[model samples]
Target: MSNLTWQIGCVRVTRIEETLTTIPLTSFFAAATPEALAPHLPWLRPHFVDAQDHAILSIHGLVVESQGRTILVDTCIGENWPESNPLERSALLGDPTSPFLGNLERAGFQRERIDVVLCTHLHFDHVGCNTMRVDDTVVPTFPNARYLFARTEWEHWRAQEDPGFAATLRETVEPILAAGLADLVECDHVVTDEVRLEPTPGHTPGHVSVRIASQGKEALVTGDMAHHPVQWAEPTWGIAADSDGAQATRTRQRILAQHTDDDLLIIGTHYAPPTAGRLVRRDGRVRFASG
Candidate 1:
């Protein structure tokens, strides 16, 4: 766990890390190449990029404490990987060891105390912790939390014939739905006065970024709209998993333009350490200024 936290007026958000590793730029980004990334390497190194120039990716969940409610953002890859999906397991969790739950409890966020489990999308990494293996059956990890899923996201993945996604749906989401603890919500559903969902599609249909507003302060929890800070410089670069690369680029461009030179904190879902920053114009390009 990075033990990183941010305050947005009346809301406090903490990062509960599950895994942190580097991925080859070519493997993670479609347009990322050594020559193409050379210009931004100065600011990207030491945090976003490693000595080998690989992208540093963090798999973690944000614990949002707002209005006396504890709302968990995206759940990272869980402890147990479905045996039926060896490809997904090997791709997502090559090591299979996870410290997510322990980190949450250490941070004072008990499983039973969680008021909501809000997933931005139904991807394997984002929704893997929705359930846990108990004996021979899978069950909801947060027994008392109401798992919230975007109706469109749920329907989209529910109809997916892809084996990896189907396995994820079976092991993580279906158990919660069967237990009657799931709630299908719109993309822009409000979780609280200080916290709400902002529809930022294209990474996946029905994908949403979380918006927090309180005491005149604001922040946006980007759910893969832009994976790395380099995207602020080149919005056209997208990950391989993107359903619509052009739409994802457009969303990034619109949001970056809207928040450029503004005070709104940009909390990236897959960013490395010092993950939150503000967008600003520098050298005729949008840059992420991490504090």
Candidate 2:
């Protein structure tokens, strides 16, 4: 619930945090071991790492408001999910005891007031809050909002047989579809004048990074293309969850190339504190300039 807000002309963006966790670098990036992170430790510590040398990541919700529409990008992990879920045991451990509804309220975003809900992919943390538990039944958290999803992304997960992910799809995604609130859209679909989806797949088959531009400023809300700032520095690192490491690396490099040596703010979906930053070029290498 930090007072984190960004303004880009007529657009306003805010972060409603659910939890912060420190996990092994290898958990996400297979090549980013403790020894590999040794040189970056000075810059990464005190904010992006803990005493135990684990990399820190946050799970939160981004509230974007523009043109009389309030949109939420990626609902953080909600409580009441099954314990057997691997993602729940990863780092933060099962939603971190927060009531997402109250966090949204504290962020000045009422559940009913949300005009649209966009999921970058069908991942557990990204879609956990899509529904809420009312008594014993799960239902749409944003009763009036249209849940926008990439048709390809939906179909990929929908055709899967994994019990854990399927449970997440059942409770978090299917309920919205059953309620007739789901809007399956193209990967590049536009949400508002200043906001639109940019297909940056590979982490998931239909992954996308959101772009926001207004006046002369711009920012990218990276869904899962690059989960950490270090990826910008070393684009070849492989992420364990990515379906295709080569494709994910390509997407990461593409985004880095666009933001490096520019003013584009890159807001990482799971980046640690001061989560929003810009990519810079130094000595022909990429560096992160925090906002």
Candidate 3:
């Protein structure tokens, strides 16, 4: 994992990159074909997207430092731990060895010192590192911290008919609950003066985005609210992973409408390197502008 960190006023956000990979644009965005992405090539190339139209995605977690507390936003795929489904598996490289714990300590964060763990949603990838294997059993990675989960998010995945998602709930989430370490919270619950969880559903029934404001500066940690930056270029474009496309579009619109400027720093959980940037209104449409 790469130690890429950014600061937003009094709060500092660091990217504990799990893995960086690419997938075809056609396969990534449901409404976009390779042909449709052609026009946006000049702006997208060599950074967000590549020559073959693959969208670059980084699976990682964000460490939010504020108010003398260390909070981990999302945990990435495990260090030596493997996953069952394709979604979780693809985020890994062959014999993936991104020593998650080693990297965390190297970044000056002690696992046992993490005050809280916030999962934006209960997708397999986002919650993979919630627990780490200990010889024969899986256990909560951060033994001394409280894990914050959205109540609706927990029930949504637990009742999923898809076995893959169900397996995810069993593997990644149940362990936390079993340990008496989870604190199921509502979507609008506040974490701190600078960090708050706000519903941005659509990717899932209870999806959320984190809002951070400090000293007149602001930032939004977008948890899959919009996967690729290209979506800002074409709002209609979307991904198949979304459980509710219409709702997701509305949520994406809401984000772009509010923060398409420098005043709000938009931090993407899955965007490639230099992942944190801002959006802008260009020719009546929202566009991804460097932050």
Candidate 4:
């Protein structure tokens, strides 16, 4: 695999896949079943362990580097999150792959070098790698980095009563806050000349996309606007996990519209390798330029 890849500037980007599993199509859409997802089989088969069908399973992470700082956009499902669904909980914890931290080290990024860790939202998969397990102690993976989060999102999730939410706040977020390392800002906050956060709510109350602009060139790190490129073609196809499906579709429509005519590079949190791409119009509709 290539050691480094860039997106129009000094910003180097990396895509890391965490796990893959399938779900019943009916769970996400009515009148859809295992057979209904068959049309997507070709696009998903090779990535799954053994593509067998109700749906395709996949999760990913993005690492962004620019100027003198390294930032992780989102963390995958952490090691010990307890899912209410027994099957999912088992698959999450029992997967034979590896500890996510090892993958970071393999990519040549020590946790200490990450000067900032940002999440588009507070979903479990996006915040999993926030902490590391060390001899029964869970600590921030990037000990020297200030964890940045949307102020509204943090406050909203912080008020939730779930154990996982509490674990993320108390064990991951609050520790950084207590240590004076949490930088909570509004959705449109700009962290640097090369990067800024654009509010794209609906998936979560405070979802935001990270925009990287330099030398008059631009790239948008779309956190979770549309989970799959299929959504670029079918704007109404939202995942069951979305907090606000209608709003998510509207957000996707606006973001997609902005990039459809230009050579705007897009990086999706759940997109596969060479995950970044250009958006173009075709047949009176927008399509992601896959490579």
Candidate 5:
């Protein structure tokens, strides 16, 4: 468990970590190269990047407690992918013994207590824990929660024929729908008065970042809109998993421009320690200043 908590006005957000590891820059960013990343290494090192310059990625779920609602945003990779799974074999290597549930409990969020399970988009890592195996059958992990999926996002992935994504969807999302626990909603569906979906398409056609506003304070839970802090300065750099790289870049530019120097707390969904920060202009470029 990362055990990181942030208070946005009256709402409480907790980070329940699933995996923290270093990924080669090239493996994550399509345009990343030693020369292209060298300039930003000075500010990115010791946190966002390791000594070897690999990108430090944290796979975690953000639990938002707002308006008497315990809404979980983006369930991290659960304990389901087997070694023989195609995605596990090629990209992840093997199934991880993730302590996600135990950590969630320690963070004081019980599975049945969660009122809503919100997925930004239907990706393997983001939605894996939507279901878990019990007695050789996969079932909804949060039996009492209403699984929220952006209608556009659900439609896109539901029609996808890609083996890796299809496999993940079958394991994680389909079961929830089968159980009648899913609510296919619009991109900007409001989860609560303090928390709502902010449509940030491009990573996927319907990818939505979480927006939290309470008592005049505000924060944004970035859902792969900008994965690494480096994107603060290099918004054009697209992740390899992006469904549309050009659109993703445009979305980053628009969101970054809106939040730059605006005092809005930007909580990265994949950032390492000190994941929450504010954007500022430094050396004529936007930089994420962790507080």
Candidate 6:
């Protein structure tokens, strides 16, 4: 398990770890196909840990506590999610006695205390805890908070017409909407003066990164921009979930360049513990200086 740290501001941000599993460079680069990945394979081997385990990706979430509000940005895969994808589902189930709930308690938050819940996108991993099953019906996980979502995101997924998509809409978003507890806002919506949304699409039709600013300092909660630090070094290597690879690449480059020379901190949704760090440009390379 990695360590956790709190970065204080108008948003008292907390980094919470759920689980970490390493993936071989092969599995990740496989998306590149044999022809494209062959030359890079040798170069990547040294940086990656070998095993039946190469995907050392950690499933985690960011809890933004601002104005007495405990807002969870994304919920890592929840326990017992009914997905058939073994690797993801296995990551979910691997922690049979996960300290997620306990960790929240220790950090001084309870489900009922959360004032708003926001998800960067509707990926299964990002919104896993949006709802939980009851005796027969699904219900909002944050009983008293209004869940926020990007308007375009909800619309795009709703139009997909997939059965599982419908299930997620019904089980997670619709119920919250029905209870008048869902805030569907545009890409530029501001949850508060301190917390606002930045339209960082491409990963998904409506993916957005959260921006927090206070005391002349700021941080961007980059939800899945680059799954890990390595991606900062190779922005063109898009993730499998990205809806538009070329556009995603453009957005990644823009974000990295904009923050690389400045003092802005980036809190990657999947970054190793504490997850909060700064981006730096060295020589001709960029990397996350995890702080």
Q: What's the lDDT for residue 259 in model 4?
A: 76
Write down the worst ten-residue block by lDDT for model 4.
44-53
* Candidate 4 local Cα displacement, residue 6, angstroms: 3.5
> For each candidate, what is the lDDT?
0.89, 0.84, 0.81, 0.71, 0.87, 0.72
Candidate 2 shows a clash count of: 0
lDDT of 6 by residue, 1-291 (tens): 334655646567877677766755556744555564454334234323333435456677778876666788887666525443435556544754445655665677788887888999887777767777788677787898888999999999988876666666666677788878889899888887788889888888899999888777888888876776666667888767688878887888988878887888888787645466777766666666664
Stretches of candidate 2 exceeding 4 Å from the true structure: 83-91, 94-96
Candidate 5: deviation at residue 110, Å?
1.2
User: How far in Å is the alpha carbon of 171 misplaced in model 5?
Assistant: 1.1
TM match of model 5 to true structure: 0.95
Candidate 5 at residue 47, lDDT? 88
Model 4's lDDT to the true fold?
0.71
| Inter-residue clash pairs, candidate 4 | 21-57
For model 1, how does the per-residue alpha-carbon lDDT over 1-291 read when each residue is reduced to its tens digit? 349999999899999998787788877886788788898889888889899988898888999999999999999888657666766545655577778889999999989999999998988788878898889788899999999999999999899898778888889999999999999999999999899999999999989999999999999999889888889988999988899899999999899779899999999899988999999888887788899
Error of 4 at 275 (Å): 2.2
Candidate 4: Cα lDDT at 228: 58
TM-scores, each model vs. reference: 0.97, 0.94, 0.93, 0.85, 0.95, 0.86
Per-residue accuracy of model 3 over 1-291 as CA lDDT, tens digit each: 357787878999988766778988887776687677777777677788877778888887899988987899888766424355754564453345555567778888888989899999987668878887789788898999889999989888888788788777777789899999999999998998889999999888888889998998888898987888888788767787888988888898887777776588888888888887788776675667754
**lDDT by residue for model 2 over 1-291, one digit each (tens)?**
464788877788888888777777767677877788787666667777778777788888789898999999999888747556745534464435655668889777889899999999999889988988889899898998999999999999999998887888988999899999998999999999899999998999999888999998898899988887778887888676888889998998887766688888888899877889888876676767685
Q: How far in Å is the alpha carbon of 272 misplaced in model 1? A: 0.9
Query: Higher TM-score: candidate 3 or 4?
Result: 3
Regions more than 4 Å wrong, model 1? 87-94
The stretch of ten residues in a row with the least summed lDDT in candidate 3 is 79-88
Top candidate by lDDT: 1
Candidate 4, number of clashes: 1
lDDT of 5 by residue, 96-131 (tens): 567778889888898999999999898877897899
Candidate number achieving the greatest TM-score relative to the actual structure = 1
